[model samples]
Target: MKGKKILFILSGSIACFKACEVVSALIKNGAEVQTCATKNALNFIGEATLEGLTHKKVYHEMFESGSYLKHIELNSWAELTLLCPATANIINKIAAGIADDFASTLLAANDYKKPFLIAPAMNVNLYLNPATAESIEKLKKRGVVFIGPETGLLACGVKAIGKMSEPAEILKAVKEVL
Candidate 1:
């Protein structure tokens, strides 16, 4: 994975901590990582931590000056894009072609010419909802890949299948595709 360019996107979730582990592992393996976060994701994981690990500024705003076309540039730059700890909101937005936020904009703008992966983390009910199921199907048909939201104890106090995959598992998936 040396010198591979990965666009790591983070969404709002308690599982951002797990995503951090994946970022660290990616850098350790010599993959170049750039992060773009949803506004809510930063509420859970600090910008400092992401910057410290990625060594690149996290882009979370769609209208930042001189970055009006940044999403397109990022899409062109990345060999792979991983949306870690993906939320139902973001998933639905991307499936519906909504680009209200920076992260959603990035997903919407991507034509899926490169590998795109999402690691979902949310309440089991949301994950299992018909709307989310349809959304996942929509993206999958468009060639987007999904990693595990494994069955386990959730932060919402429910032991169910809404947890994001562990870092090692996600990294393994990344390796497999690359």
Candidate 2:
């Protein structure tokens, strides 16, 4: 993975913390990683932590003046894009071509020629919602790869299939995609 440019996008989820491990693993394995997060995801994981791990600023806004064309530029620069811990909201937005937020905008503007992966995380009901399932199918048809919302104990105090896959699993998926 040396010299490969990876864009890691994180969405709102309690599982956002695991994205740090994904970033660290990517960097440790010699991939250049740039991270972007939804505003809500930042609540679960700090910008400093992401920056510290990635050696690059965590982009959390679509309107940053300094990064006027960041959504486009980052896609062009990355060899792979991973939406680790992808939320149902973000997934639906991307599936529907909504670009209201930084992450969604990035997805909407992406050329889709690169490897694009999404690892969903949510409560069991939400993950199993027909809308969410349909959205996932839409994204899959568009060539988006999904890692997991594995079946297990969730943050919501239930044992079900909504947990994000572990960092190692996500990293393995990233490697396979790359």
- Pick the lDDT winner: 1
Question: Candidate 2, TM-score vs. the true structure?
Answer: 0.98
Query: Model 1: per-residue lDDT, tens digit, 1-178?
Result: 9999999999999999999999999999999999999989999999999999998999999888978999999999999999998999999999999989889898888978899999999999999999999999999999998998899999989899999999999999999999
Candidate 1 yields a Cα-based lDDT of: 0.95
Error of 2 at 88 (Å): 0.4
Deviating ranges (above 4 Å) for candidate 2: none
Q: Give the top-scoring candidate (TM-score).
A: 1
What value does the lDDT take at residue 117 in candidate 1?
A: 95
- How well is each residue in 47-154 modelled by candidate 2, as lDDT tens digits? 999988987998889888887799888989999999988888998898888899888888898888999999999999999999999999998998999998799999
Q: Show pairs that collide, candidate 2.
A: none
Q: List runs of model 1 lying over 4 Å from the truth.
A: none
For all candidates, what are the clash counts?
A: 0, 0
